[model samples]
Target chain A: MSERYLFRGNHAIAEGAMRAGCRFFAGYPITPQNEIPEYFSARMPDYGGVFLQTESEIAAINMLFGASAAGVRAMTTSSSPGISLMQEGISYSCGADLPMVIANVVRGGPGLGNIAPAQSDYFQATRGGGHGDYRTPVLAPNSVQEMFEFPKLAFELAERYRTPVIILADGLLGQMIEPLEYTFDPVDPKTLPKKDYILDGCKGRERRVIRSYDLRPGYLEKLNFERIKKYQKIEAEEVRYETDHLDDAEFVIIAYGTCSRVAKAAVRLARNNGVKMGLLRPITLWPFPKKMIEELTGKTRLFIVVEMSMGQMIEDVELVVKGKAPVRLIPHPGGGIPTAREIWERFQQFREEL
Target chain B: MRKVYHRPEGLTDTLMRYCPGCGHGIIHRIIAELLVELNIRERTVGIAPVGCSVFADEYFNCDMIQPAHGRGPAVATGLKRANPDLIVFSYQGDGDLAAIGTAEIVHAAARNENFTVIFVNNAIYGMTGGQLAPTTLPNMVSTTTPRGRNTKLAGNPIRVCELLNSLDGPVYINRTSVHTPQWVLKTKKAIKRGFEIQMAKKGFALIEVLSMCPTNWRMSPIESSRWIEEVMSKYYELKLFRDLTKEEK
Candidate 1:
């Protein structure tokens, strides 16, 4: 049975993780995401789950490494600076092939940027932020309802690919209140595929070793090739995006996360003003919906990339567009969301240049 | 004639990878021997630190994980918390635990995380070509400390067991060495006791061994063994710092 309830985005994410059978959660207190661990602390103990407030972000992520290796669903949450502290562990999880979920309630930052909503972490989340030639599947949630839904999907993708998955939510989505419908079924650990490589003891089985270090010649290369193969599989099968008024539109806007919601409103306004504008919201940022951009380049007159950063994802959009269509970027520096009126204004300015 | 001596069931047939006369092989043997004797060989999960002992998973005939540098305890905490019935331990070297990993070990102890930690303090970084470690004694020369280490400049050696003894989280804390046959037996007893405390679900337990690094110490095996007894043991000491089970009794 499904139920609907009022929830803040952070609370919806917490509930969504619990529904996805996260039995262990460890985190440190950070703004915009403190409510995540705070909610788990009150709720996990009642269900015999472990909720730990670690000393630092480093400790929390390492705890996730341990819990996941023990063959249980484990997770951690942090904002920007905290996520920076977690880079080494994140890289380690990738190297060791541990399945875990991380939620970054992104605040503005190059370093201690601000405790406001921002999509500045787009590059850090999409690209491997740590020292590795690897990529984690990044899910960007544009709505409070998506905040409730992406956790389950993140865990599934993580386990399916044997890699870490990130739910990239900005502060606006995390702080805003909305009605969320529970659509996912609570998963049972027993029903999940047996993790034969976990470090849960060697009883009645061959001793298992989970390590990333390979000093031998050509050994690490082989391991990296395997990782690349898995990533290719993910990129092939897991590209997700939402397209609105794309067909027969003269102007198109590419955005994700909070900016997507704003772009949708701007598209509506542009249509009312006799401008043929469409919006494409990428839900899976890493396995980016590049195919859609390729298909739309010939149909649209101009592609406008909207983001709350100094133009990160625009590079990716342009790479796919391949100069078939002229591309322009409307940048919003961190710490606040651009209003629909502001986005509509940008559309008008770009149309004038056209 | 009966076969009087045989390799323990907890060790694989893989040849030892430690440098000649390194203390890691002996320590590995002791852990395997204890695991077999305690009958927890199968239900034991060991986390290998990213140091000289990073390949420890290859030697142990049980489930093992090689965590990133200084992340052994954090990994062990997660493993033990998730699987309460399993016996979990982490094998770490001095640089791996006492230096970059100081925050992790200290907080793990403060939390009273129920697990065992086998800390091998050799006082110098061996795997990365003999750099000065946090446990490196004053005036000790390494690749990094070209001249003798200056306490005023490089900070004094960290007595890990003493530092951790200040924390109230751990149930058993002891420092032992394996310089001689007698000391080997005592170190083994300490390792076994750590596992016993974890089995009792007391709290965190640690057995810090003052191991040897002959190649990096620029000495012969026997000379390094003497150095540990004469120099390392003088400062680190060979004594139990805390024992909650003894207090209860």
Candidate 2:
């Protein structure tokens, strides 16, 4: 049975991590993400776990790396700038196929832009960051309940795929309080599949060397191919999306996270006005519901992409739309989220155009 | 109970590719030989660093992960966290650990990260040619410090063992040299102690071996070892910084 409780998105995440058997947390506190480690630091010791507020994001990631090497569930949370500091470690985790979770509570950015909410890291998170040919599972949580459940799923997915999985949320989602339906139950690690690729110690076992060096051109290529194969599997099986009220709509809006929440408001208003509009939120930004959206080309005549950035994800929308429908971009920058009133105005204007 | 001299199970038949008189060759052998004795080669995950030993991954004949320069500790830490069941170690050079990755290695030790660190202090950059490193001794002349290192401007040489010893988390920190037959034996023992601490799942352990970089030092392997003993050991003292059994909580 699903458990329920009252908590903020950040607390929900902390509760979810605890539920998912994450016993180690190494994070440098930043705006919107400070609560996670703060919560864990106060609670981990009671569970015989560890919570370290590292000197910097770099140290936190490496510390998380060490804990993960021990075959324990470990994680780290940071805002955009801190996440930027951690990208190198994240890429290494990917190259090594290390199972762990990295939460990015995105705030405004380009360069330490602000301490306010923003989805400007869309390109960086969804696409691979750092110097590498690798991709991590990117999960976008839209609500407080998702914040509670995603970590359990994220950890499971990471271990299942033997790769890093990112929980992409914004400052707003991270800080705002809501009634979360978790933090009431504990997750058992024994029920999970056994992970054998850890370095506990060379006692009673052969020396286990975990490395990611494919120097031989042929060998490196083979490793790359294998990674791609795994990515393909993830794309096929892990792509999650939610569609609302578009069965016979003429116009559909593509968004994720907070943007989707606003688009829903617009969808409701436009539907009442006989404007036939709906919402398509992409939860897994990496696998991208391109095929799912593609299948809707017959029904989705006009595509409207709403985002907090300068239309980064719209590119993906256009790629899938394939010019089949006229794709429109509605972007708002700075510290503000797109309000329902503004979205409704835009949706109605686009409604008349179609 | 096991034989003291058999090749470790994880180590392959390929001999290390380090140059003659290279301390890394001896260190690698010692680690592999110890793994064989302990019989845990299959569970050993090595985080390889960039340097003359950048490809140490290939030579180690184990599951190795190549991390960026000075980031081996970070990578090794990640592996250990994700797989607490594995025995993880990072083998790094002075240039990789002390200079480029100064922050990473230092903070890792400071945090008392649970793992083992094999720090080979050769005092000079060997892989990239005869360049002066952070650990280069005073008055030492290399390609960069041709006229000798200016203590006034170039600053004092780094003593890794001393620096690491000052940290709070590590279980053991020892400085050993590979200058002579006797010292080589001692260095091997230090490396084993480090691995043993890691086996205990104790906090961080490190062995900073003052090694000779013959090709980079612009001297014969024998002279390089002599310089290590005469000059390097002077700045870096040989002793245990923290012992797990005595100091662990």
Candidate 3:
């Protein structure tokens, strides 16, 4: 058995990235996520990694673009407003097909809403946040253990796809403390496969150019089509989610990240109270559990979607359900998190109406 | 027959797309020649900015990356810090360096990043039609400045070398023009010095080259050179603003 330690979500993310062979990190300080940069500043040098407190989120993301193009695993973390500043660079990374990881410890938003936990960036994260014909795979982690384990998986997926990956967490998940165990052995970067498209130099070979624009008549169109096929393959192969009591579930609760923790509790509370409620927590938000939801639609009576937003992921669930089952939203928008009692009470009322 | 002059091996066979009499071709040739002379072509990484030289990745025979507009310095910082052995350079224009990317360049210099910056100041935006640039001279008319540039409303032009000279981080800061053959040689020397300082791991260095934009200036190639000599040079002085090498010696 591996050793277990009590760690905060933010510090676990930093340690996880270090063990995953992340050699470069550049980020600016922001609310709720400041611990990530602080942890990296204290520990990254000991790991023989580069740590840069960039001037702004824009510079941090662009720095990741450069470092990743030079063939190293790089990452950055920010909150919502800062992540907004990084959209341009993120779009450029997608266009250039460079691999890197970004973590957004979400907070209330529209504009500087608050530093409390919220999931208002679902549309922004699932849909490409920047101006481009592209999509970034998003991982939603609910626990400190998932936070500790997700970076390695995120880096692997990023390199495997040659695309940016986002770890979408909230302020609550980042600040909470929990005990976790290291699931995988530490990875040595030297043992990793060599990247052929890196821009180290043109020593004894043809020169390489990493660029995003093709101004030719039909070149950009062809590039977009190729990228679409890659995204399609990802959609088919990479959908991840966790289901609890789905075998005999009459009422299904669909959620992700911090909201799903409350949802899982509500499911157990309903089961003890002699109700048949189930939970489906989507781990990958972009390659959503569409097929499973569609399959569940035939047997379920009602799909209750719980979120900390006005209702972002519900649109995806509803799209897949396609009116086959009745879909309802339990929203706790803008810094408010639902409790197990509150969710169970809401479910009781909905079931009475049904 | 002995080869009196030939193309530098650092440049590819691709034909350049710069306009007639534009100074980008001249500057590109100078950089290419120096890359061959320094024998760092095999280990050099060049950053192309978002301007008329956006296609520079195709022209330079080295590993290149074209990042967002004005983000060349930040990208170079990443590349150089990640792999210190790679000689990195950021090639940018007036709009790219002074207008959109001011924060990145300022912070890179403040950190004393060991990289070279090739700043081509032509006093007007070239790629996006002829708009007034941060370096546009007083009373110089551009597409945006239908009337002569009013210092009251638009503010005076920025002298980049003077501004950066105020900061102690930069090791070498020079401003040279390419209007005449003699001045072109001087500009080449300044660029070589910038790269040499970076190779020695000294600190940040920038060579600001005063270039001609004849199509935007509404002048003939000969007239543009004369205007740079007479008008543009008076406001943005042609001189070395700082040099730490001399201090060390």
Candidate 4:
């Protein structure tokens, strides 16, 4: 009764960030993710926050690094190419363990990959972008409600892991409106833990420093190993996925982000027709739910992977399946949201093959 | 007080990860000294770049935040906007500044962001090993430029300060070099001035330091420095494109 609000996914992200103590925002306008910066820019200052339209996605991400290093919550949003521009900054944030949120309303890519609803950035976001061995925690939100709720989770994840967290949505999820709830206590930026690494102003205090460079070859190697250890722990602890109708199904449809919504709709369509297909939706991409996928391999021989990309996450599903099951990709890039009929047809083709 | 030229106390006690003769070290040291002298060492925040300067935060004694490559300007913009009292700067390289990040640099400067940019321009890429850069001069040979940089084929290297000067944003823009002791001193002065202007809230300040890549250039460090003076300067002439101290009407 107490936790309801009417909001769009993008607005929810802005609200969540504000609730989570994010006081700065810098972003270049892009499809799907534009509303996020638009909301913050228009309303942030009214709430004692600062909003800026950065020169580029590259600028927005670097701005996030600046604000986050100052020990405040900050974020930026963009689609495909914009996200590519942000890879370098994302790597730096990962290297430095800076806490910030990056939202990628992915569209198709390679060049200015179309801006329709596509999920082509899976490889870029989950893989170690930029250079070096570093990974940020990537979350795939399936609904407008999840969209609003995930920013706070992202901030917490970023602070807990001392790294960046990405909210990987697509055009559909970003554009859609939904009912959501605000669950957290009112945030006071003044009471947040003091960041020993923040660069305040040089008026007082001893010099403070932050960096990912370890010149000693051995030490660099050790530091990299330690970072990997942290990633491993995160993979183990942060892997989140949802299983619906998993108990009574011969075919389990695997998807994430927006495609999973299509998959959810397809599950209902297939069930009404007596085909009976369950769904497995992964929320976390980097610490991918490999264990869950591995376990699901025994329950189903045919698994359908729908994505906006050509076949990146499907590759992850295959890796865990280890040839134990059949995995296929229903790719729609450039923000193309597939219809329930298309998914149903794909399921028919898979069933025919079986 | 002692000069303490080795490094700054706020700077990380890390050695150079840059390849031999990389100009990033020179630029980093100059900025480090400026930060130290300005006594903003404690309150300063730096956004490190991609390419060779990704480790910039490591060498600086101030609070460093390594941003996604090319995203330094954006991050620094956020930091500066969030806390107008904080001193924020972005140390970016040619590849990071003029290539994929061109829009970012232009827009940040265009917006008259209250920060400084230490842009290190080496005609060839350094960190990922020699490749053609945005600042690569005509007839320059690099990994991607097998038969020298052809302006007709690969496009002319952008003169950042000149290009930015054409805009209405930046309050200070100086293009210098670190190829010689005199130039290094000049570069340091330019850096200090940029920081000084930022402290005074003049506007966006940029110090484009003509740098060198010895290993990538297939030349000795000394020769590379000389090349910067003899060849690169001919293409990217040293000039102060904007002077914030002059009080624009």
Query: Which prediction has the highest TM-score against the true structure?
Result: 3
Model 1 lDDT per residue over A142-256, tens place: 8889988888899889989889999999898999999888786777666887777887788878999888778899999999999999999999999999988888788999999
The CA lDDT of each predicted structure is: 0.90, 0.81, 0.94, 0.82
Clashes found in each candidate (C-alpha, N, C closer than 3 A): 0, 55, 0, 26
DockQ of 4: 0.48
Q: Candidate 1 on B1-249: residue-level lDDT in tens?
A: 999988889899998779987999999999999999999999999989988898898999999888889988898989999989999999999988999899999999999999999999999999999999999999999898889799999999999999999988899999999888898999999999999999989989999998889999999999999998888899898999999899989
Candidate 1's C-alpha runs over 4 A off are: A1-3
Q: Judging by DockQ, tell me the better candidate of 3 and 4.
A: 3
Docking quality (DockQ) for each candidate: 0.88, 0.44, 0.89, 0.48
Quote the lDDT for A146 in model 2: 92
Question: C-alpha displacement of A99 in model 1, angstroms?
Answer: 1.1
Instruction: Give the fraction of true interface contacts kept by model 1.
Output: 0.90
Residue pairs with colliding backbones in model 1 are: none
Worst 10-residue lDDT window for candidate 4 chain B reads B3-12
Evaluated against the true structure, the overall lDDT of model 2 is: 0.81
The lDDT of model 1 is 0.90
DockQ of candidate 3 is 0.89
Candidate 2 structure quality by residue, lDDT tens digits, B1-249: 976676555466776767888888778877777766766566777878889887677666556666667877776666665566666778999999999888888877877767788899888898888788998988999898999999898888887777777776777888887788898899788878887777878778888888888887878987887887777777888777768677535
- Total residue pair clashes for candidate 3: 0
Error of 3 at B71 (Å): 0.5
Mark the regions of model 3 whose C-alpha exceeds 4 Å error after superposition.
Answer: none
Once fitted onto the true fold, the runs of candidate 2 whose alpha carbons sit more than 4 angstroms away are A1-3, A183-185, A201-207, A349-354, B1-11, B33-46, B55-68, B72-89, B113-115, B138-156, B168-171, B192-204, B237-249
Error of 1 at B21 (Å): 1.9
